[model samples]
Target: MYVCICNAVKEKDFRGAARRCSGGDAEQVYATMGKVPQCGQCLEDAEDILFEERQLCTRLPAANACQGLRGLAPA
Candidate 1:
């Protein structure tokens, strides 16, 4: 589950970092987390995780998906 071999960062760590960088550039995430992208092999993996998180965040909230309650609350 290692995401950045150069920095010895784990996938979980990357996920957390991505969440924190939700409103900023991804490069800032790398810099703040001290993750150096050597050879760029892990770039795709990092981006994949970020993209997945972004997709999940954009989806309708679980409570909002319930029938007859779609507009009862804010997402």
Candidate 2:
């Protein structure tokens, strides 16, 4: 899905940038991607994607750690 038509940035592109960039801030991700919001219409959607991507990235390590602990706890 195209998030930013003006800059030709896709939803995945923004999500990738957001995951790579700290803070998961849409603006910062845009900066990292070498683009910025122009019409502002895509800002909300971009932020949503950024948040979702950040959440997924943050939870993975925790989930894996739990799995490792589960293996250690039973036997």
Candidate 3:
């Protein structure tokens, strides 16, 4: 489940980061976790996984809210 093997970041780590990005900025998650992207290969998978997780969580708002500028607000 680790998203970035080089950095030792897990899928849950990415999930937590994505959740924190309620502000609609993945950079916030990256910064908070102090993770540096090594190879760019993980980026797409990380995002896709995060998206799927969010979709599965009914507690979260509709996915669209987290799509554009709307995601800048609270989740």
Candidate 4:
């Protein structure tokens, strides 16, 4: 579940950062965590995670939005 091994960022941490990220941008997510992609290997996966998190954020009901997107499988 490590998304950015360079920064030791796990998927759960990435999802939390992604929710707080305004643009759902991979770079921004990294920045939010005070890290950056070093080897560039995890960029794609990071972007995918950010995208999926953003999608769930928009699809969920307002009251429950961004509470935590657990249980839902990626589309």
Candidate 5:
């Protein structure tokens, strides 16, 4: 999906940028990817995606830990 319409950035692109950027910071992600926020409306969504991506990264290695847990599913 399109994350940043102003920069034509996709979610995958944002994920990659988020990994490269520090602490999952949305602003740093944009600067690291050489993209700048224009309309500014996308920032909230972008930050959300970044947070989700970062959270996923931290949990991925231990994914099996929650395999049988209840209510830990994605929304």
Candidate 6:
């Protein structure tokens, strides 16, 4: 799905940027891609995608750590 038409940014690309973004900021995502939000129409959707991706990124590391710990537990 095209999240930012102005910059030709797709959802997948945005998700990658979201994961790479330390602050999980929408603007930073755009900046990382060497693009900028124009017309301001895609801001909301971009932000929404960024938020969802950021949430997933944050949880994934912890989920993986938990899985690793599960193997270490006393059996």
Please list the Cα RMSD from the true structure of every candidate, rounded to 1 decimal place: 8.4, 9.2, 5.6, 5.1, 7.2, 9.0
Per the 3 Å backbone cut-off, how many clashing residue pairs does candidate 6 have? Answer: 0
TM-score of 6: 0.74
Task: For model 5, state the Cα shift of residue 42 in Å.
Answer: 0.6
Q: lDDT, candidate 1, residue 65?
A: 21
- Cand. 3 TM to true fold: 0.60
lDDT of 4 by residue, 1-75 (tens): 899888999999998887766563688779978998899999899889877886776677473546544443433
Q: Report how far residue 43 has shifted in candidate 3, in Å.
A: 0.4
Number of the predicted model whose TM-score against the real structure is largest: 4
Candidate 2 local accuracy as lDDT?
A: 0.67
lDDT of 5: 0.69
Ranking by lDDT: 4, 5, 2, 6, 1, 3
Q: Return the TM-score for each candidate structure.
A: 0.67, 0.75, 0.60, 0.79, 0.72, 0.74
Which one is best on lDDT? 4
Name the better of 2 and 3 by lDDT.
2
Error of 3 at 18 (Å): 1.5
Clashes of 1: 0
- What is candidate 1's lDDT per residue for 1-57, written digit by digit as tens? 898887788888876776556343445557768766777788777777766655554
lDDT of 2 by residue, 1-75 (tens): 899999999887776676566453577779988998899899888877766665565567455322212212110
Which whole-number lDDT from 0 to 100 does residue 32 have in model 4? Answer: 78
**Candidate 3, lDDT over the whole model:** 0.60
Report residue 11 deviation for candidate 3 (angstroms). Answer: 0.7
Can you give the lDDT of residue 64 in candidate 1?
A: 28
lDDT of each: 0.61, 0.67, 0.60, 0.76, 0.69, 0.66
